[model samples]
Structure formats: C-alpha cells, structure tokens
Target: MVKRALISVSDKTGIVDFAKELQGMGVEIISTGGTYKTLNDAGIKVINISDITGFPECLDGRVKTLHPKVHGGLLAMRSNPDHMKQIAELGIEPIDMVIINLYPFKQTILKENVELHDAIENIDIGGPTMLRAAAKNYQDVSVIVDPSDYIKVIEELKSSKDVSLKTKFKLAYKVFEHTCHYDTLIAKYLREKIGEDNFPETMTLTFEKVQDMRYGENPHQKAVFYKEVGANKGCITSAKQLHGKELSYNNINDANGALELLKEFSEPTVVAVKHANPCGVASSDDIYDAYVKAYEADPVSIFGGIIAANREIDIKTAEEINKIFVEIIIAPSFTDEAMAVLSKKKNIRIMQLENIGAPVPEGSYDMKKVAGGLLVQNVNRECVNKEEIKFVTEKRPDEKQIEELLFAMKVVKHTKSNGIVVAKGKQTLGVGPGQTNRIMAAKIAIEYGGERTKGAVLASDAFFPFPDCVEAAAAAGIKAIIQPGGSMNDQASIDECNKHGIAMIFTGMRHFKH
Candidate 1:
C-alpha cells in the first residue's frame, strides 16, 4: 500500500491536483519549500521536510532533505524482516513514493551573461541523491519524476492502493536515465567552460524525441526524430514549419543536408538537394535570379528535391519556385505574398529558420550510429582561400576562372565522396555524387554539364587516383580542375593536364562528405 508519498519539484505545473488526488487516496503527502507552500495554499494537508527530518532547511535550501531519516526511509528494504523491525523501532515510516525533478540547470545557463556562481548554485545536489535512493529501492517504493505520469499513478493507487512492480521498475529506470542526463549536461557545460575538448574518458550523449517520423528511409521501417537536449538555435532541428504537411523521415534528412550546405554561403543563394546531394546551387545579388539559375542548372534531378535559401524569399522567387514540384522549401524569412503563393501547394513543407543569418557552431561533432557502436567526427567547416591554391600546370587559370573554381570547390566539399562538381562563373552546372569510381563520376558530371562543359571548371572532393579522370575531363572540354592532389599518381594527372593544355590547381585539402 502507498501509505506515504514525498513530493518535490522545480516545475510546479499540475502539482496541486496531483497532491489532492494523492490525499483523497489516503496517501499522506510530504513536501518541501515551494511545493509544500503551494499545496498548503491549495488546502492540501502536507508535512514539510523540516518537520519530517526534524531539522531546519539551511545553506539556502541546499540542505533540506539530505538527512538520514529521509534517505533511510526511502532506501530501507520492506522485504527484509530486520529492516522493517529497525525502522519500526526507530519510529521511521516507510516512504511508499518519491516525486522529484531536478532544478532547471540547463535553463539557468541559457541566460546571457549569467554568472558561473549562479549556474553552479542552480545545480541540485539533494534531489538526485533522493532520486537515486528511491530508485535503488524501487521494489519497496514507487518513484515519479514526470508530472505526466501523475494521473496514471493515481488511477493505479485508486484501483488497489498500490502500483504494479512492472510500473515501479519502469519508473526506476527513468529515474536513473533522467539523473544521468542531468549530470551529463552539467559536466559537459563545465568542461566546455574550461575550454576542454569534447572527448573525455567517458562520453554520454543525450537527446529527446521531437516526433515520430512518417517513416524511415524506406516506408516500412519504424523511425523517429530526436534533437540534442541543449541544441543551439539556427539549425533545422529548431526550424519552425510555417505551413504544409507533417515532415517525413526523408524530408527531415534531406532538409538538414540542404541547411548544412547552405550554411557555407552568406550571399543570396539557392541550393536544391536531391537524395542528400546538391543537384543545383547558385548565388546572385537578387534572390529571384539565384533561384532561377539554381533551378535551370538541373531541372530534371530537382523534381522532388528540397530547396533552401539564405535570404528572405520574395514573391518573385516564389513564383519561379512554384513552377517546380519541390518537397520542401526553407529560408530565413518569406514575404506574405510569397507564402500565399507557396501555400497553394498543400503538400509542400515550408519552414523558416530564424538562424539562417547566424554563424554555424565551430567544432561540433557530426555523429552517426553503427551496429555495435557510434562514429563521431568533427563537422567539416574547412575552406580554401585563394592563397592555398597550388597552380601546377603549364597553363594557369585567369582571375574569373579562379573565382568560379573556388565556388565549385565549396559545392564539392559538401558533396559525397568520389564527388565532382562542374560550374561556370557562380552557378553550378552539374554534380555527380556517391559514384563507386572516379571515372564514372567525372563522366556523369561532364555529361550533366553538356555544352556548358566547354569553359567550365571542375572541383573534385579528393585526389585523382589515376590520370583517366583528367583525360575524360579534357575530352569533355573542361577548362580547369581543382582537387586535393594527394595521390601517389599525382604526377600522372599533372602530366595529363599539361599534355591537354588544361589548367589545374591543388588545394592540399580534401572534403569527403560521406
């Protein structure tokens, strides 16, 4: 039977009704501080922790419930005869339930210019201890941390004056999980404040589910979307879907890819992504011109792709975008007329990313999961300046071609491995991603470029393993090439470029997105 229940929380939502329901079920309620005052004001009979422990709250409410009497009642095993006898003789009542949620440490640190002392003070020491004690003795005491479970617990008690062992076990697991995450956030923040690297001896990742996705990569597999607990603003996870249908699994993935690539540019740029690879990317002074150029680059591959822009979308741009069947459109902002035009398409998901103008967080991890473990690597934010280029052929690219080559290099960096991008000026003409062989990728990009290949510059994500790709590019009329140039056969490619009278540059850096 749940004869006694302890309640304490920082978020006081719905606690009064919960306490009243517990009281009506013949469960004596014991609370502390704000919770006790709120429950008493609501006319719910309660015993303060000071009364229960026979000690006043000290150290600014930090030492309220850390006494042996409280933890002893929570940790004692009811199944042991000696334990029950000792508690009975010592006038200690068995605590049948413990309700606790830690202080808002995460929220406290979010405030700008918050003092380190204030942040440290918000970290609750006694709450996690009590939670651990009760969870360790879950076989004897029921524990609740989430207020959503209150009604269910009350129903269970009203039915039989007790909750099932299965429920208790589940609640115990949640208690441990919650406390572990709390500690991880506190530890990570402190470490980062001291300018330490993210990788420690032991690492624990924490996330919370945002929603159940429509489906996984395929329609049959079950999938859900989760966001980091302390994720910063300006990413797709924090984007607001202003209109259109619910986001599918593929929509979220492809949209995130588009946003990550879009972060590379601060100009009025439009990026069209298909299957997580950019099919078209263009930048111009006018947003409409940017969208049109990007769309014209590869209208075929962008049939059902996601598109994003760094600038506020205008009506003229929306009119051009509405001509295509896009799955999603995201931008910093959209004009009212632009939204009205785009809203005509009921199935297109439209989102506004408030941080489209903000800078990406430096040195964050791009993590992936595997069968037995996880793979963690720093997010690639590397870029090549004009001084970093190594012009290594008899011929050298002019100022205009060099500018175009750099633009294509940025596009290639965000593409998958064995990727190639062909471009002229500021607009991308073609991109080949995820090809098993370099020759095939070169051919795909050159073919996609068509007549545009005559004076186009090509950017390779990695070094050319053989001279065949350089031969293929020259045969297709590619004017210049930029690559990492780290292969043992670098001389072969340079010889091929010189033999064909083509200009080539080595960046000394590779960008393999996969």
Candidate 2:
C-alpha cells in the first residue's frame, strides 16, 4: 500500500524540508494554498489540494479543504473492509498522516490598532476540521499540529518506514488539544467584542499542559501546570524555575503572591511570602538591607517562606539567606559567586527572572476559585494618595501617621478579602489576611500587633461594612483608619470613629480579594 499525507499550515517553519523528507520515503504529498506554493518553490514535488479533491478553492480560499474527499480520506478506517470498499469505489486514497496548524488568531489580535474584521478573518475552520478528522482515525492516521514534531516524525519514518502506533496516538491527542485551544481563543475574543460577560450556555476551556509537578499542596494529591494557550508573557505560568525540587501547588501560589507584591515597588524591595500572603515586605536604600529588614519583620514566619527581590542577588544576601531554610529565592539576576554559594543547598529553588521590575498590564482581571465555580472581576488599580484622602475627624494624623497609612494601603491591596494590616513607618506591625469577616480580621491584626499597634495606622482593603471593626481598632489604640467609604452603613463606622476621637480617611476606592 502506498502512503499518502496532507500538509496545511499558516506557520511555514521547516515545512519544505519536512515535506521533502516525506517525499523521499515515497509518500505522496497533498497541500493547500500557501504551503503548496512554498514547497513547490523549494523544488519539492507536491500535489495541490484542489487537484486531490477535484474542487477549486472558492470564497477566497476558505472553502478549499472542507469537502468530503479530503475528510473521507483522513477519517476512513484502514482495517475496516466496508470503509476500504467505499474508498475504492469513490477513487479516494487513504491519507496516512496529516500536518496542520491553524491561522494566527493570537498574533493577529495582538497587533497594534487591529480591526475586528481582520481578527475575525483569522479564525480558522477547515484546518481544525482536518486535524480533528485525522485525530479521530488515530488507529490508521497520524496527525501533527506543532512544527517542533517534524524532526521526530522524520526520524521515526527513517527508522521504521512508518510512525509507531504509540507515536500516532500521542500526536492524535495533541491534535484534539490544539483545535480545542484554537476554538477557545476565537470564542473569548469574539465574546469580548460583543460586550457579553456570560458566554453562551455552554462553556469550553482549553489550557496547554506545561508540566507535571511532583505533587500538589500536600505530598499526596497529584497536580500539573497548564498555561493559557496564547501569547502571554509576565505570567506565573511563564516563569522559569532554574533549580531545586519540583514546585508544589502551594509553592507556585506563594511565588505568584510574592511576584505580584514585588511588582508594586520601584525601589529595591524584598517580600517574604507565607501561605499565599506576605508575612513581611520592606524597601530600603539597598537590596541587602531590604531583605534583612523584611526577614526580621517576622522571623518566625520567614523560616520556610518564599522570598523575592527586585535586584540581583549578591554574595552578602546569599550568605544571609543560607542561614535560613527557605523554600525558594527569586531575583532578576544572581552573581556567579552568589549562585555558587546558594547551589550548596540542592533542594532550595532559585530563579533568575529578568525584567522583574517591569510594569504589568494596567487593567487585568482577578480570578478566584470557589466550591463549584470561579469568580472573576476587574482588579483594583486604585492607589491612595494624600490629595485623594479626606480625613473625617477632629484629631488629624501627624505627618508620620500619614506616611504609615500610605504604606499600609500598598500592603493591604495585595491581601485577601476582609484583610486588615497595621504598620508603623515602613515596618508592618501585624497583618491579618484571608478572613471571612472584617471584624475578625481586625481582631487578628490587633492581636498580632499586640503592644506594637498603639500608634500605628490601620489600613483596610475595603470599607468597614460595620462599626465593629472601628471599635476593635480603637480598643487596640489604633490612631487612624484608611479605607474606601461606600458602604451603606458608613455613618455607623464614622460615628464610632468620632466617638473614639480616631482620625479616619476615605479614598473612595475598594480593594476586595477573595
């Protein structure tokens, strides 16, 4: 039996050489528009897809490969006698392999000033159809969706004269995954244009498997990393873990928190993260001093926490970090001597992330997982400045208190919902995060603050929502409060603050993280 293959692609990387290699193995090559031209131009004999299907490409080449001849060739089962009889009667040859990639929808949308019509035009139809058809007949046909697979396919054909059954099955799985991800990007883009939040009754999500981790948050559960199947940079999924044990679920979560918090500061900064929340964060004149102060802020919590820095790690910082059993350390770069010192601890993960200080997208969304579903919302990008804040009490905050309030606001924005953070100067006195009730979070913050919160300014990520939080802060001797002021019972909170003679300010912005 003579083998036949179909090739269609928008990205033409290494296609000419691959097709030539297939031709050398006496495999008939069938290809559509641009791919046919490129392969022929490169001195490779190829049959145009129209010739094979006996139909000219119409509707500006969109209807070329949708015909039954192409799909029937791909989907027909080689082992079934009836399917073979039908193929012989129809004069259709079996397509043993398919190589295809979709139109560049992701790249088209990312261009500057891209019109909607251009984006819609980039949505592929026939390519994904052919991929699915070939994938469905994996018992007889092999499919290739990525250009990187060409070398391996060629090598296997050279050795065995045909791809192995295991290789065909794996490639078929990749084909399905590719089309699913392609359709997902198209749907998400079109939905956004129509101003619809709730997509059609049906939901289809696609993520490419990035890695299989050693385990989940604990050692028992299994976990894997999947990245959004599109061009996305500066995301936690794209980060490179240079060295150490495989990351756990909790490690990735804490690393994301540490990176997000580090992005907010322009100066050399260090943040110690524990349980997906910042245990201590500080900025100083030097990166080493910043790490020292942040670590000292809560030495007990910093024992096995993840640390991130905006500057390169030096020998001095490595020496200090080596004293503790930290799980991970991330920085923009590391001195050769510094890495040499830290490399002694084989289990500690070290990452060199370039451009750690670059500004992220201005208006990204935040997603949280619930029991049965996910909640998505626009991120709170509001920053509290002195001019935007309105003090609502007789006793005004001193200059030092005002500075501390600003510092506290930065930390609180990164905390979970119902979060309260107390700070004196640049050091955090106490942080109570990820609670169900505002008062409970406030009580935890105060208890952690202990005697240290006496004159510290308190920052709430959102409004009080009740007067109980104000009472708790006053009882802890907190002198001032800064929060968004939109709750319906705002007066009760104001009344409590006035009675206690505590200064309060409203920035007219809310930061809720659930």
Report lDDT (Cα) of residue 506, candidate 2: 90
RMSD of each: 1.4, 4.3
Q: Write the per-residue lDDT of candidate 1 for residues 1-514, one digit (tens) a residue.
A: 8889999999888899988988888889999999899899999999999998899999889899998789889988988999989888887888999999989998988788889998999899999999999999999999999888888888888887799899999999999999998998788778768774466766787777999987899989999998875546778888999999999998988998888888888788999999999999999998899999999899999899999999999999998899989999999899999999999999999999978755556546788889988888877777686677799999999988898888899899988878999998689998989899888888889899999888889999999999998998899888899999989999999999999988999999988877
lDDT of each: 0.89, 0.84
Best by TM-score: 1
1-514 per-residue lDDT for model 2 (tens digits): 3299898999999898899899988999999889988998999889999898889999998899998789889888989999999989998888989999999998898787899999989999898889999999988898999999999989899988888889989999988778877888888777667764453566666677888988888889899977765435555666677788877788888988888888778788898999988888887888899899788777888899999999999999999999999999989889999999998999999987786765555434566779998766665555776577888777777787787788788888888878999877576777889998888888887887789888888999998778999999999898899898888999999999999989888988777776
Residue 51 displacement in candidate 1 (angstroms): 1.4
TM-score of 2: 0.80
lDDT score for residue 250 of model 1:
88
Mark the 10 consecutive residues where model 2 has the least summed lDDT. Answer: 358-367
Backbone clashes for every candidate come to 0, 0
Clash pairs (backbone) in predicted model 1: none
Candidate 2 local distance difference test against the native: 0.84
